[model samples]
Target chain A: MTINASKDLYAAVPDEQGRFGPYGGKFVSETLMAALAELEVVYSNLSTDKHFQQELDHDLQHYVGRPSPLYEAKRWSDSIGGARIYLKREDLNHTGAHKVNNTVGQALLAKHMGKKRVIAETGAGQHGVATATIAARLGLDCVVFMGETDIQRQALNVYRMKLLGAEVVSVTSGSRTLKDAMNEAMRDWVTNVDNTFYIIGTVAGPHPYPMLVRDFQCVIGREARAQSLAQTGRLPDALVACVGGGSNAIGLFHPFLHDESVAMYGVEAGGHGISTNQHAAPLTAGTPGVLHGNRTYLMQDSDGQIMDTHSISAGLDYPGVGPEHSWLKDIGRVNYVVANDDEALRAFHKLTKIEGIMPALETSHALAYAETLAATMTPEQTIIVNLSGRGDKDILTVAEIDGIVV
Target chain B: MSRIAGRFQQLAAQRRTALIPYIVAGDPSQDATVPLMHRMVESGADIIELGVPFSDPMSEGPVIQQAHERALANGMCLSRVLELVQEFRKSDDTTPLLLMGYANPVMYMGYKAFADAASAAGLDALITVDIPPEEVDDINAQLQRVDMDNIFLVAPTTPEERISRIAAGASGFIYYVSLKGVTGAGHLDMEEVTQRLAAIRRHSQLPLAVGFGIKDADSARAVAAVADGVVVGSALVNAMAQTLADGGNSGQAIEAVASLLGEIRQGIDSAAS
Candidate 1:
C-alpha cells in the first residue's frame, strides 16, 4: 500500500520534529541540535515569506533557468513501440542536473539565516558542483566534502568545483565513499555551526532536511505537472526517476503522489544484481536502521554495522534511501525497482544514440527501467522520465569501460 | 547515594577534581580490558568512561575512530563490552564506570534490555553521544529505573536555554566538550572554557566534567581548575596506539596509558591542591 492519495503530503508528514511515520527523526549528535532547531524555524518562516519566494523564483528563472522543457523522445519512444515517452530535461539546469534545485533553495535559506559559509557532502560531484555554483553566485564561502575514492574517480567535477572557487575536502574515513563524506560533512557542520550552513545534497539526513530538500526539489514535479497537462492535454500515465538518496525521484514523484492514475517508479542502482550483494537498492533489499541522521531502510549486516554498497554510479552508491522514500515504500505509494550496471550502461548508449541526450549514469537507471515499462504499456499510454543530469562528467568512466581513448 | 554521586561527594570533600580516563572497550585486546582498567585506577584515575565501539561515530575524530576500528576488528560487540564491564566489576565495585558511544547498538538491544544488562553489569552511567535531551527522555526514564545515570553532553555549541533542559535529565555529570571540534582536537581555549563553564554553571548544578581538546596534563589542570572533572580520551588512546605498530604487548600498552593518566591525575590534584 502506497501513501494515501486523499491525505495532503505536506499535512501528513514530518510533524514539527521532522519525522515521517517511524522513518525520519533527528538521529544526530547533541552538538547539532541547536543548529537544526534554529534551521527549522528559519525554513518555516521563509517558506511562506513572500520575499524569499520571490528571490527564489527570480533565481530559478534567470540564474538556473527553471521550467526545464518536457521534450518528447519520439525516436526512443518509437523504438520501444509501446508508450509515448517524454523527458523532463533536468539535465539542462545550470549545473547540468536537478541537484541545483535543492542547492539553490538551501543557499537561499543560508542567506536568510545569516550564515556566511555553506558546506556540502557529495558522491557523484553533481551536488558539489551545484552547491559550489550557488555559493559562488551568492558570494558565500563554500566547502565540499568528497570521498577519497570519488575525488579520484570524478576528477573533472572536482576541477569544476575548484574552478568555481569552492574548497574541496577529501574524506578518508570508512570505505572512503559517499557515506564517509557525509559523516565528515556532518562533523564539519557540528564543528562550524555558528557561521556555516550545511546544505545536505540529498533528501535524507535528519528531519527538516528530508522535508526541506523534498520541498525545494518539488519544483521539478510542479513544473512537470503543469507542462504535461498543457502539452499532452492530460497527465502522463507514468512518472519515473532514479533514486540516490532520492532527491530527483522525490522531486518528480511528490506532486504526483495524489494522482491515482499515475504510476510512480523509483529506480535504484543494482551494481551487478541484488542477489550478488553488490547493489545500492536499500528499499528493495535492506532492513530498517539509523544512519546519517535518520532511521530508514539500510544495507547492514546482522550485528547492525552498515555494509559497503557497490554501484557503478557514484551518486547511487549509498546504502540508505531517504526516510520519506522508505515511508512511501512501506505504504506502497511508490514502486521501488532497480537497474543493474549492465542495464544502465545499455540505457546510456540507447538514450545517447536515440535521443541525442547523454544522460548521467544515475539518470540512465531511470531510462533503463522506463524502457522496459514502456514496452509493457500500449502506445496510448505516456511516461515522463526525469533525465536528472547530463553525462559529460561520466564520459571518462564510460570510455574506460569501452576501452577507448577520450 | 549513587556511585557517581558518592565519588563526586568524596572528591568535593577532598577538595580535588576527578580524573576520568576513557578507552575503547576491546581496543588493545578484550582480555586486557579489565586489567588495563584496574591499572588505570591504580594510576590515580577516579572514574572510567568505557567506549562501546560503534561502526559510525559521527562526533569522534580520527583517534577514537581508529580505536573503534581496532576493537571491532577483534569482533568486539556490545555484549562483549558488557561482559568486560562485568569482569571489571567483579574485582572493583567502587569506581564508577560510564559506557560511552552512539545509540545504534543500544537501539539494537531494546532500551529496557540494554538498561537491564548494563545495570546487571554494574555500569554506573551512560553517555550516548548522538542523543539530545528531547529524543532521550524515554530512554532516560528506563535507565533511571535501573539506577543508571544518563550523562548528557553540553557542547560549546549548546544553547544556554537548552543546557537547563539537558541538565534536567542529566546525572553523574554533564560532559562539556571544551572545543567546537571533535575528540582529539587541539586548540583548547582556556578563557573560552572558563566563560562557557561559568554560563553552564548558572543553568546546571550537575558536576561538569570537561572533555575534548584536553591533550596534556597542563590543559587538564587548566580545565580541572574550572570544572569538577576532567576527561582525557584521545591523548591516552593515542598513547596506546603509538605502540600498536611495533607489536607491543598489552603490558607495554597499559603502562603507556596508565603513565599518561598518572601525569593528568597529578596535574588535576596539584591544581586543586
Candidate 2:
C-alpha cells in the first residue's frame, strides 16, 4: 500500500503542541514545562545553525564513527531463499550500539546551553554508557539512574558508566525497572533544573525530547538510504527494527516515511507471547494511555496502572512505546509485529552461527521478524534490518538462561 | 459557585488561610479513608485532597510514593476512590473534596465518564499532576460541562507568560508548588513562594494554594502568611505510614493523620491572628 505522496509527512509532525496526532504531547509536571520550552527553543535554533550542524557532524564522524556500514547478508539471504537481506550495522558504532548517535547530539546541546550537569535513566545500560562516555568527554558531571534489577543484570555496563565518571543511582521503586528509574531521574531533574540537562535515551518523554532524539538518531536511516541507492541502485523493499522506546526504529523509519514505496516493520518484544500478560508489546497487546510523559500505547491494567512486563531482553522490557510509533500504527504507515522470547533467541543463535555475527537480544527481535518476512518475498526484493546493538553485554543473560555459569 | 471556590471565599471572608490536608484514599486500608476525611474536616481542614493511587506517581516524593504503593497494595483504584468520595459525602457534604492524582487512571476511565462520575460523587475539583494547561483543554471542557473545577499548578519554574496562560483557564484556584521538586521535598524557600504567588496574582483572580515542603505547623504557618491556602500532603501521609508501620490499627492511623491536620490548622489560624 502506498501513502499519498502529497502529504509531506515530515514537515507537519509533532505540531506546535508536540503532539503526533494526539499521541505525543507535554504531559509532564508544571516544573519541567519551562525547561522543555527552553530546550525546544535552543534545539530549533541550533538544529538549523550551520556551525552547530558542522560540530555535530564532526562528533558523529570522529567520535561516534558515523555512517555505520550496511552490509548485505548474502549467505543468510541465500539460506532463506527469498529476499536479499542487508544489515544496518549500528552495532559497530563507538558504544557498540545505536544509542551513541543520540547521546553525542544531546551532550553537545547541553554544552551549548551552558548546562554543567547531565542526568539519564537507563534500563539495559547501553544508553547510560553512551551518555557517560559523552559526559566524560565534555567534562560534565553525570548521574545515571538505573533500576536495582537492571544494575544487577548489566553489571559490566554499570561499571563502565562508573569508570566514565558517572554516579550510578540505583532506583528501588515500582518494580525496580526502567520506568522507575525514569521517575527518579525526573524527580532529580525537577529538583536541580537550573544546572541539570536530562538526556532522555529514546524517542519518548515530553515534547521536544521525542523530536530531538529522533533528529539525532535519524543518522542511521540517512546513511542506510544513501548506501542502499549507491550499492543496490534502489531503496530497500522493507525496513525492520526492534521497538523498545523505538529510538533506533524511528531513526531508521523517519527518513523513509516520505518514501511511499518503502515498507516498514517495527518488531516489539513479545516476552512469552502477546496472548499472555507477560509481554512488553504495547502496540500489539495494550491500550492507549499516558505514561512517562506521553500518551502512547501502554501495557496498563484496567485501572490504568502500568503492568509489570517480562521481556528476556532488559532493553525491551518497557511497558510503553514511543508516541510516533503509536501514530504510525494508527495511520497504517508502519506494520508492528511481535517476536516472542524463544523466537528471538533462535534468531540470535542462528545469526551467531550462520552470519558469524552476534546480535543483541533486543536486536534479535527485529532479526527474527526480518527472517520471517524475507522468506515470504521474492529474491528481487531487499530487506534491511537495524542491528541496533552488539551482543557482548547480553552474553551473561544468555548464559544464565541456558543454565550455564558464565 | 463550585464547592472549592465557595470554601476559598468563605476562608477569605473570615481572613483565614484554608488548610487542605491530602491523603491517599486506600493508604492504610479502604475502610479507613472515609473516617479520616470526616476527622480532618472536623479538625478544621477546609479542603480534602484524596489521592488516587497509580502504579507510577512520578511527581511524588518518597513518602507519598510509598503511600500510593500501600494504597494500590490494598486494591485501590479510580472506581474505589470515587466510591470513597461518595461515602465521605454521606454525612458531610459541606467540606470541599478534591481528587489529586496522575492522569492515566482518569484517562482510562474516559474523560467525560470520569468528570461525570466525579461530579456525581461530590468531588469539587481535580489536580492531575501531569496535565498542565497546554494539554488540559479536552479534560477541562468535560469538567466545565459538569460544573467542576480544574486546578492547575504554577510551579517555581513556571515562566510569567505560561502563568498568565495557565491562570486564564484555571478554575477554583491556582496550586503554587512551593518548590521546584516533587511533593514531600524539603527547603520551602518562602521568598520564592511569596514572589511567585505575587506574579501569579497579576494574571488571574484565582486564589493561590501553596504546597510542597510544608511539613509542620511552622512551615504551614510560614506558607499561610503569604498564600490563601496551605496544602499539607507528605506530613500527613508520613504520620499515617508511621502509624501503620508501628503496628497501629486503622483508628490509630486516622488519629495520627488528624492530629497533624489539627496542628496545621492551628498554625494557619495563628498566622491570621
Candidate 3:
C-alpha cells in the first residue's frame, strides 16, 4: 500500500462522516453520546483556537524544553559506511522520555474540563510515571493502574509514582500486562465518569485520544524539522523511529507525512523472530480488529483472542499498534518493518560503544534500522532517527541478558 | 415458592435484613461454580448476585477482576452462565438471583436474545456496571417485556433529576455504589450512603442495595440497617484469592467464603432483630 505523497491527506481524516480510514469513529454508549458530540465540537474549536495554540506553544517552549537537539552520529554513520546518520533527541526531554509532552497537554485539557481526578494505565511504566508527574504538578488527584506483572518488573517506576503522590493500583487480570491495565483503566473511566479524566498513555484508545495525543506529541517532529533544516540546510532523506503503540513515531511522523521527498520507516520489535511466538511485530504479522477502543492491526490467534506478545523491552511487548498507524500503514505513508531481538541487542551495544549513548531497548529497534539505512545509501543522503527515550530504566534487563553486573 | 420481590418484601415487612452473597460463576472452573452457588444458598444466603464473566470490569478491584478474567479464559460465555443459573433454579427458585456484569457481552449477545435467555434461565434481574438508566434501550426493553427487572445504580454523586430518571427505569432494586471510587477502594461513609439512599427513596419505592466497600459483616450489617440490601463482592473475591493461595480451588474457596457469609448473615439477623 502506497499513498500519493502529493495528495492532500489531512482531509482524509474525519472524512465525510468523521471516520479515520475505517479505523476510528465514535463507538460509545448513547448515555455519553451527547457528551462525546459536544467534545468533538469543543475539540475542533479548541484545536484551531489561536489562544489555545499559543498557550500550548508557551508550555512546550518553557515548560517542556522543546526544540530538542539533532545530533549527527558521525561514528555510527561511519561504521555503517552508508547514509549520514542524525538523531532527533527526544530522550533528552524533561521526564526522561517523550511521554511527558503528551501528558502535560492532556492534563491541561483535563483541567479545562473541570475534571478533579486523572486516571491512566501504563505498560513499561514510563507513561505512568509521566502522567503521575504531571498530575502531581497540576495538583490533581492521580490514580494509575498498571498490570501486576509490570508493577513487579518496573518496581522503581511504581515507587516513583508513589513519591509523586499518585495511587498505584496493580491490575492482575487477563494476561497481567498492558492490555489488562488498559481494560482496567477503561472500567475506572466508566465508573468515575463525572469528575475523572482518563489520561490515555499512548496514541491508542478511541477517537480523540489518538488524534489528541498525536497533536500534543507533534513537538517531536516540529522540533526535528527545524533542527534538521538549521543543521543540514535541508530536510533529511528519510525519517525513522520505533513504534510501540506508535506515540513516539507518530509524534515524529505527523509533521512529515506530507513531505514528498522524505521516506519514513517504523521498526517494530520482533522478539526472537516473527516466526516464533515471542514477537511484538503487530504491523508485520497482525490482522485488523478492535481492542482498547478503535479498530487496528492486532496480534491475535485465529479465534480473535489477543496473543501474548514478548520483547526484550517491556514497552514494545504490545499486541497492537495505534489505529492511526494502521491507517498510515494501509495508506503506506510509512513503511513498517521488524527488527528481531538479536539485531536490536547488537544495535544497543553498538550505540553504547560508538555513540556514547545507550538507547532504550525499545529505541534499539530504530537504531537497528540505522545500520540498515546507513549501509543502503551513500553518505550524501541523511536519515533522521527519533531517539525516543534513554535506556537507564532498561539497564537491568539488558545487563541480565548480557550476564553483566552493571 | 415466591417471586423475588415478594420474598424481599416479606423480609422487609418483618424488619429483617437480607443476606446477599456474590460469586463469579465459572471462576476457577465451570464444574465447580453451580455446586458452590447451591452451597451458598444453603448456607443462609437469601439473595445471590451471580457475576457474569466479562473481558473488562473497571469498577472491580484486582481480586474480582482476576476471578472474572479466569472465568472468561475458561470459556465462560453469558449463555453458559445463564445455564448455570438454570441449574440453580431447578432446586431453589425462591432465592433472588441478579446477574451482574459489564455491558459489552450482553450487548454483543443482543439485548433481546440475552433477556430471553436470562428469562428462560430463570434469572431475576441484571446490574450492568457501565449501563446507565438513561441509556437503557434494547436490553431494558427486552428485560421488561420478559418481566425481568433491570437494576440501576445511584452513585454518591447522582443528581436529583438523574436519580428520579433512574428510579423510573429501575424495577427490581437500585445498587448504590457507597464510595466515590471503584470497588474495593477503602472504607465507606454510612452517613453519605444513607443520605444518598434517602434521596433515591424520595423518588421511587424500589429496594436499594448498597455495595462497593461492604467488606465485613459489620459493614454489611451497617449498610443493611438503612439500605434494603447489601452487595458484597471484592472481599469475597479476595477470600477466593486467599483460598487459592492456600492451595484450595475456587469451589473450596467459595464454600469457605460462603461459611463466612453465613456468619455475616447471623450478624445481620441479630443486628436487625
Candidate 4:
C-alpha cells in the first residue's frame, strides 16, 4: 500500500548545501568550484527577472507556438461511460513534442548570457531534435550526443537533427544508450564551457537546471489551467501524462500540484511488469540515488552503479526521473504508476483506430492508464491527458511489433 | 588557483604563452606515473592533467582509449588515481593536479565524500569528461566550497557565445581541444588551435591549454608557442604501448614516456625562452 503523503515531503539531507534527502549534493573537483558558484549567482538572478520571463513567454507564444489547445475526446469519452475527456496537445508544439518549449527558452537564455553554442543529450532524440531545432533558429552551432545503441534505433531522428544543423555524436560507452549519451554530452559541455550552453532535456540535472526547465515548461500548466477552466468551468479530476524523465508530466502537473481538487497520475514505463527486472519504474521498484547530475530515484544496483533500464518506449528508457517528481511523489501531490508494454501497445492501437491519432509510444502509456481509470470512474469525472509527442518517430517501432511493413 | 592560471596571467602581463602536458594515469602503473608526473613538473610543465581511466572513453582516440583500458585493467579507479596523486603530492603540492574522469563512479561513491577525499588527497582541480561546467556542483558543493578550480574545455568548433558562457563558468585553466575529432587522430590544425585559443582568450583570462593531437616533443613545442600549455596523450600512450608490446617492463615504459614528456616540456621551455 502507498504510504500517506508526508507533510514535509522533501526530507532534508544536506543542510544549506542543496542535498536531497541524502541523495543530492555537489561532488566535484576544486577546479570547477568557482564556476559552480558563479553559475549559482547567474541562475538565481535569471530566475527572479521579470524581463526574462516576458522574453521567454514571447518566444514560446510566437516562435515555438505556445498555448497548445485542449481537445475534448468525444469518441474515447463515450466508450468510457461517455465521460468527458480532454487532451492537452503538447504533441502539436513545434518540433513535434513539448521539448521545444523548454529548449527554445533555455537557448534564448544562453544567447542572453552571451553564449553562442548549445549542447544536449537525447535518449529518444526528441530532446536532441528540439535542441537542434532551436539552435538552427538562433543561428547557433549545436552538438547532440546520443548513445551508440540509440543511434541504431532512432537513426531517423539523428538525420533530422543533422538536417537542423546540429552535430550528432554517437557515444559508444556503458550500456551504449541514454546514460552514455548523457555522459558524452556532459564531457562536451565541460570541455567547451567557454562558448557553450547545455540545454538539459528533462527536470533532472542540477538544481538550477531542474528549476529552470520546470519553469520554462510550466507554460503547459499555465495554459492548461486557463483553457480547462474556460472550457469546463473547472479543472479536471485527474491529470495523466507519461513520465519519461518527467518533463511533459511535470509541465502539466506543476501548476495543478497545489490545487487540492485535482489528482495527478504519472505513468512510468513498466516494460513487462513491476515484478520483472526489465522495467523503468524507478520510484516503485528502485531506490533513491544519483544519476545524470541530480539526486533522485534511480534504477540502480546495490553498489549504486546506474543500471541499464528497459522500456518498449524509447523515450521512457531512462533509469531515473526528475528530482522534483520524486519529491512530488513523496509528498502525495502526485501518484506514480506504471503501464506495461503490452498495455501501452493496446492503448496505442486503440487511440490510433478510435481517434485515428497514433501517439508516441511514451504517450500510449498514459492512455493505457486512462483506460483503466475511465472504467472505474463516473461520466462526470474529467481526465486531461498530455499527448507529449507525435508518433511519427515511433512508426518503425510499432510496425515491427505489429508486423507491419515500413 | 591553478598554477597554470597564475603562470598564464604572468605571461599575459609579459606577452608570453604557457606550456602544459597531459598523461593518462596508471597507464603503466604507479612505478612510472609517480615519477613521470614529477619529471614533467621538473622539465617545464606549467600544469599537468592526469586522466582517470574509465571502461569507455567516448571523446578519446584509439590510442588514449587503449591506455584507459589498460589502466582500468591495472585496477585504476578514483581512489587508486587519488592515491597516485597523493604519492606525487609529497614533493610537488604546488604543481596543480587536475583529475579528469567520468562521473558515474564519482557519483556512486557520494559527492561530498569524494570531494572531501579528493581535497584531502591533495587534488588542485577536476575536469569530469562528461560534466558540463554548469552542472559541476550537482555532485558536491565542496568542489566549489573548497575553492577548487573546475577546468572547462574549449574546442575548435565552439561558438563565440558558448565560449563566453563557458569562460564565465570556468576557473583553473581552459582546455582547448586542438582538433574537431577525438584523441590519437593523427590530424591537427596548429593554426586553428592558435586561432581558437585566441578566440577563447578574448572571453577569458584563464590559461588555454591545447590537447588532442600534440603527441610528441615537436608537436607539444609547436602548440605551446601559441597556447598556455601543450597536452600530449596518445603519443605517450602509444610509446608505452609499444614498450608493453615488446614485453618490456610496464614501469619502464612509463619511465620512458615520462622521459619523453620531460623532453617535450624542455623543448617548449626553450622555445618560450
Instruction: Note the clash tally of each candidate.
Output: 5, 0, 1, 36
TM-score of each: 0.97, 0.99, 0.75, 0.70
The C-alpha lDDT values of all candidates are 0.91, 0.93, 0.80, 0.77
Compared with the true structure, what per-residue lDDT tens digits does model 2 show for residues A211-253? Answer: 9999999999999999999999999999999999999999999
Interface RMSD of each: 1.3, 0.6, 5.4, 6.9
Give the Å shift of residue B107 in candidate 1. Answer: 1.5
Q: What does the lDDT come to for candidate 3?
A: 0.80
lDDT per residue, candidate 3, B110-142, as tens digits? 788888888998988888776655346756779
Runs in model 2 lying further than 4 Å from the true structure: none
User: Which candidate's DockQ is highest?
Assistant: 2
Poorest stretch of ten by lDDT in candidate 4 chain B:
B131-140
Lowest lDDT sum, 10 consecutive residues, model 1 chain A, at A1-10
Give a tens-digit lDDT track for model 4, residues A1-406: 2434343432332234445444444433222334445566776687688998788888888987878989888888888773477889988888889999989878877887788988999989999999999999889999999988788888889999999999999887677777778767766765566677888899886655666687788889889989999999998899999998899998998777657788889999999888888989997788776566566888876435567788888789888888877777775668999999999999888888888777889999999998788778888889899988988888888888889888
Sort the candidates on TM-score, descending order: 2, 1, 3, 4
Residue A63 CA displacement from its true place in model 3, Å: 4.4
**Under CAPRI classification, how is model 1 graded?**
medium
What does candidate 3's lDDT look like per residue over A1-406, in tens digits? 5577664675467453335686754433223333444455666778898887888788777877886789999999998889999998888877778888889888878877889899998988889989998898889999999988888777878899999999999886777788888878877775566788888888887667788888888889988888888899999999999998999999998898888788999999889898887899889998776566555788866434567888877788888888888888988788999899889999989999999998888899999987897799998999999999888887777777889986
Backbone clashes in model 2, listed as residue pairs: none
The deviation in Å at residue A117 for candidate 4 is 2.8
lDDT of prediction 4: 0.77
